[model samples]
Target: MAAVDDQTPRAQLTASPDGRVTIPAPLRRAAGIEPGRRLVAYVEDGRVVLEEWEHLLRRVQRRVIAATSGHSGSAADALIADRRAEAAHEDVSADATLAGRGAHGPDPA
Candidate 1:
């Protein structure tokens, strides 16, 4: 018996002893939820939010785009840049090791 805005679609749902709740057909249709549709549920701002998997995916994608909007290039580009940095570090380490060694091998302790 939670209070919701009158303008928003509201339904009284009763959970079974096993904690299963049924979403009414009207609400389901309004939310574009069909039978066997995948759903993601979580609490947002102290309220429970149930979203379709597809909708959640799109929301996340939008967030990612907004976050990286200032940055140039795509995910693949970022990954390539990271890999290049790693390779350069490895090369520098190898060069240092080689410089520390004598022509034959490591110097006697």
Candidate 2:
């Protein structure tokens, strides 16, 4: 366990057999944890981390911005361009096939 600094928030909690750990009112107030608010908990660097829903959302947004920062356009634009190329290829193939069999389309049976 890492040594706790005086400025870091501290609380002693006990978990019940059912695995529920209730946050004390003072700590909850200090942490801005509302009664009905959602939280995301995960282990990081061997320590348990509890993050509020909004905090996680902001963190993910930052990560996405960092990842796509160098791109000139959004990923959706690139996907649309690829789809258009595929559609054009299919159209050319269909035209070639139609030309081979005449405009009447494939012969019956």
Report lDDT per candidate: 0.63, 0.63
Question: Which runs in model 1 stand beyond 4 Å of their true positions?
Answer: 1-8, 72-77, 80-109
- lDDT, candidate 1, equals 0.63
- Inter-residue clash pairs, candidate 2: none
Which residue window of length 10 is worst by lDDT in model 1? 99-108
Candidate 2 lDDT trough over 10 residues, lowest sum: 98-107
Per-residue lDDT over 38-109 for candidate 1, one digit per residue giving the tens place of the 0 to 100 score: 665656889666766656556555655565556788889777666655565565445444434422343345
Return the TM-score for candidate 1, rounded to 2 decimals: 0.55
- For residue 10, model 1's alpha carbon misses the true position, in angstroms, by 2.7
RMSD of each: 20.3, 20.8
Report how far off residue 22 is in candidate 2 (Å).
1.0
